[model samples]
Target: MRQALLLALAALVIVSCGRRGPQPQAVEPQAFADTTPPSIIYPAFGDADPHPWEDRHPGHYPVHGLDVSRWQPPIDWRTARASGVSFAFIKATEGGDFADPKFDEHRRGAQAAGVPWGAYHYYYFCRPAHEQARWFIQNVPKGADLPHVLDMEWTPHSKTCRIRPDGRTVRAEAQKFLDILERHYGRRPIVYTTVDFYGDTDIGRLPKTEFWLRSVAGHPRNVYPRAIWRFWQYTGTGLVPGVQGKVDINTFNGTPEAWAHWKAGG
Candidate 1:
């Protein structure tokens, strides 16, 4: 009984008291698939390690999704989908060569489960942007339900590439990558970035580009000033049902109607 209490206390520290949305019943939480209208379903997931949000809590947003890599064990995409996981972004490739072994499995799993899934390419500074884009295309198949993402960030610990290019160079490379993907995929890709990288490169300067910003400690408005963001990655240690390990969690920046429209590629 004491051990149970200790476990409960550990879980209690990772709560979003700021979540001001309707929560599922504590007795039997509502499955997102079973929700009425299905457009606005807030899957009341837990966080293994959470950042207390003072405002703009992720739960307040009706739509949520997750990003997965090989670091995570095999995910039960059907279970995840039914549990308010409206979308998924799987890591596909990195640099010009290293393709994630789990990409094919995850992509197929998400598709079979009827989840709106897309692939994202992690940036490598040492590699040419065009080569990286081609590598991603080669690995991730065409005709996905969502736009692909370019994950550009500073790789400080990378042995092969530790060089930080100037804002101009970074912008140029990003544009090249974006344009190539758009031409090939017929959809403008979203750029996923973190705070420090955004601060250094000023990626928002890129023309006609959408962003998925990572701001775990605070709202995107507080971290990414003046930059319009479509998705906000609010936590890295989110605990969702059907996933074996902690995963990154994100929420759409719009209402159910807007989410439907956007996901329809409008």
Candidate 2:
């Protein structure tokens, strides 16, 4: 597939300030024509809409949300919520080393804003799944709204890239981490990866896991073979009102009730 090809070629590989310095520039990702189906197009939800809000506001989208690590600025969560952010994912830790300093405050602030939250750990292929799982279990706090994520990708520019593991090894380790996270959090963890990364890894093997897919052009199914995406991030540099800068835009799958069921595991 195109994604698989990109992943093989990628050998390849976010933002902001105050807490920790930004990582080095990432390699330019290989672009692919989006071929996802229209039935899977993520529509706006509830009273808060992402399209018109962003269009009318010029740079702001309502219900817009973002993820951050030490390299990114400390977001004004309250402002973000007031402006209409419904959810967020914070970087908690990476591999078996390096924890984001802003995670604690971001977690608290987002909760205070009444936003549903999730946490992500940058995957290091060189690390053992058990080791990384243990690290995540040790650091992230348990909470009602928190879901865990596995950030899998090929980071060619990474200082730690030399030891990047193969896709099968990557899937094995990720599954281990996901299993541990599910045990601690009492919910099936989400898998976050670019289309290319997903195709490169054995993601299809973990069919039970919900996916948080990154597809800039269209829905995941059109772009991927038998894609089962629960979340679709359509844009990364999306301009939204109320927020200070560009924010990532995503669509949750299913209807309102479906969203509720997914959220409550009902």
- The best candidate by lDDT is 1
**TM-score of every prediction relative to native:** 0.84, 0.72
- Which stretches in model 2 have alpha-carbon errors above 4 Å? 1-64
* Tens-digit lDDT string for candidate 2 (1-266): 99998876654331223247667533212112222333342323232233433211212122335666665466677766666566788889987887889888888888888878888898877778888888887888888474678888778788755565677787777788888888878987888888777777767567467777887655565666566666667666654444445556665654445455656764
For residue 134, model 2's alpha carbon misses the true position, in angstroms, by 1.5
Worst 10 residues of 1 by lDDT: 26-35
lDDT tens digits, residue span 90-191, model 1: 999999999999988898998999999999999988988999999988998888999999999999999888989999999999999999999999999999
RMSD versus native structure for model 2: 15.4
Which candidate should be chosen as best, given TM-score against the real structure? 1
